[model samples]
Target: MAFASGSRADRPNIVLVVADDQGWGDVGYQGHPVLKTPHLDEAARSGLRFERFYAQAPVCSPTRATLLTGRHPNRMGVFTWGYPIRPQEITLAKLLREAGYATGHFGKWHLGSVYRASPVHPGRMGFERWVSSPNFFDNNPIFSDEGTAVPFQGESSVVTVQVALEWIRKQAEAGRPFFAMICFGSPHAPHQAAEEDRALYLDQPPALREFYGEITGIDRAFGMLRQALAELGIRENTILWYTSDNGALPKVGSTGGFRGNKGQIYEGGLLVPTFLEWPAKIRTPRVTRVRCCSADIFPTILEIVGIEPPANLPLDGISLVPVIEGKWERRPVPLGFWHYPAPGISTPSAKWMAELLAAQQKGEDLPPDGPSQRAGQLPDPPYPSDQFPGHAAWIEGDWKLHRIETAKGKIRWELYNLEEDPAESTDRAAEEPERLGAMQKRLEAWLRSVVQSLNGADYAGLGESPSLPESKSR
Candidate 1:
């Protein structure tokens, strides 16, 4: 049967649940023997599981920025972790809000400060309500409740889902459509799990035991969320998207035999497990091999709600609605990724940002990174350079091209047919000379466009004043 096709009210409610560092093979459905993820496994079996989905970038903040804005993270100068997104850039929440959908955010919000006064906080980003952490947190986290830090009980994922469900229930009771972004901080570093969850992996090594337990905790929490949706009777018309922000961590996470781990531009770093469940639209369960990215979320949601982006805006993502309906087989537009060379800001822990938010409420004066003010800064290059001085890649169909910058300031190019080399072991650059040359030109042009955006081209005529913070590179 065809998916629902009707008025705007028939449109599905969208929920995006992102994991911090869950790997491509971390779930039970992906053949992980140690980790217990029955809820995610069931979702994969009952939905459209993306076999070749990728995160826009191989990190937390940048990928999250892409998920909301449907633009490359670098466009708004969010090149690394803890970098803030530009306030002027349009966000998915704002777009959906204008379309008459209520929006809320829960869990880890590493994109910027959770403090209410920050220009790029979740509230300013279009989420009407939010309970977010500045970064990753463990059990019993202190969350910024719409800009005020408050203590929450329970494991991280469980706490996040509970708050989200509360907001969702409120919307459903009021007969209003809603969008909820649930970002989990599980399976990241400093793995912490409830005693019961950890007990499931006690036989394993100490480190692996804790890591697997955290994932199990996330699985249980997700199952609770799915149940809530069904009981609320919104499951039939809700679009639920689940995936990680990036690839796996070293030693603890699995990349499913792909090359490289987190922080690289390789398949392992970029590729992540993704599943979408829309009971009203996707009547049958299936797996799709089409390449998709986190950036595609914005356009996909827009297509579902029959909303068009502002004219003259350049979106890096194309709508995947056709792909979902099984009409479009191949990706129409090439995807680009660049890891700009820089180190992300390192805080002592989640408490640092929580304290900052608390300080802001007191109306005290503090430095940008201190308790009173918690704004992150983006880079302002001396001049827009012609050189693409970083590791970058462009994927078109099964062909993947890579440009790596060496420490000695040298550039190297590598090409691979991903269909024949999922591991990216063989460099076909020598044999496919003409094809490689064409891809290089396309990549260079794409990089040039991104540079233009970094310099504030997309915000033309938005009338919002720009906030250019002081630049600091590590």
Candidate 2:
């Protein structure tokens, strides 16, 4: 029981609802052509809608790492698809637990290899009770609860809501200030829905038919989630944060008017919908246009709880508490982003990623080194880390610079002033050489700093003060 027992005056339960592969246009507020999300829309209507909010990465594990650790996924060792979040990193759950919030992770836990001995398993990663899956589970899929894989009935979204509801109820009964993360793997892939959710979109266009069904199912589950919170009399006090893992994935929902699908560094890949609903705190539904990211979640929670990080390990995210309270206009600091090392497995999951994760990390102390320690493993050559051309981007005011390494010239860079080109349709790199070069230098310097921390070069210094991208006066 790592969760400390704090005084009642110092605690508030946190419920972070993450929808997998859910797009900006999938919600009712965002105006999907046919999707029905009455509950989520109401959450948006009654809470603060964060426009220009982004997932830390273009994928789930990376984004989750950001939300939990208040830093880039690379800094925590979750670089790409199927990479496990290294155990040494700090997570929101761990922080909240230290601050006396009982933490539980319900739904998908994709930050690690789901195997029983993975170091980064949910239980080992600071969660008190974790009912999770290795990754996105199709309908009626198996879930690893703490250690055992159990079959769950009903749709994926519905089951996720139910598990979370049960956990919250238990925590409430125990009089504990709980921090539960419901990482719903809905709308991710293998888009399937119950007949009820399916019928709503059956008459729509071929492209939206199945996709809408998936979102609807997720919506219904969201409704149930809200109802459960209200029924428990905790809806008003709980901080309910809703957002997605990444932007709209390909062959699925719309990314609103943004260009490029998931996997690209465009706004579509990074920018997803976001909102914070706390009826007691955010009584009015205010639309905030400030830019924020998944990394902010952890630090904000710590700030709200008044648990100042040790003098050594400062946080990367600024507290949005003042913003939520309508006390500020713009973030006083700059935001950072790096889609680094590239899109490949960056961890030690050699060959057992599939079966091992399903079993969950059962043993105590769960072995530290996963696939990496296995000889003849370590993944083959052309690792995304080595071959994948990565782009380190920085958005200051209206400008975003992406220094890419394409054959177009080894040191290619593209600049997009989002104020003028929200869709990022045109590449003005060659046109504005001077401005591009300046921004590229800034981006490169930031990349170097990120790489230093990501490779564990500055863990000791991190506790003293989290690294920041060198400030540039745009």
lDDT of 1 by residue, 1-474 (tens): 233345657767999999989989999998987788899999999989998889999888899999998999988888888877777777888787767778888988877677656667777778888888878889888887766667888988999999889889988887788889998988889998899999999899989988999999999999999999999999999999998999988899999999988998799998898999998888899899889999898988887788887665678888888888977667988999999987887643366655665676697533334421433333355336477777999999999999987756688999999999999999999999999999999998999899887776666676753332221110
User: Per-residue lDDT for 383 in model 1?
Assistant: 30
Give the per-residue lDDT of model 2 (tens digit) for 348-398: 222233344443545322343444223112223313323224665777777
Judged by lDDT, which candidate is best? 1
Q: What 10-residue stretch in candidate 1 is worst by lDDT?
A: 465-474
On the 0 to 100 scale, the lDDT of residue 276 in model 2 is 87
Model 2, stretches more than 4 Å misplaced? 1-6, 205-207, 310-316, 341-369, 372-389, 407-409, 428-435, 461-474
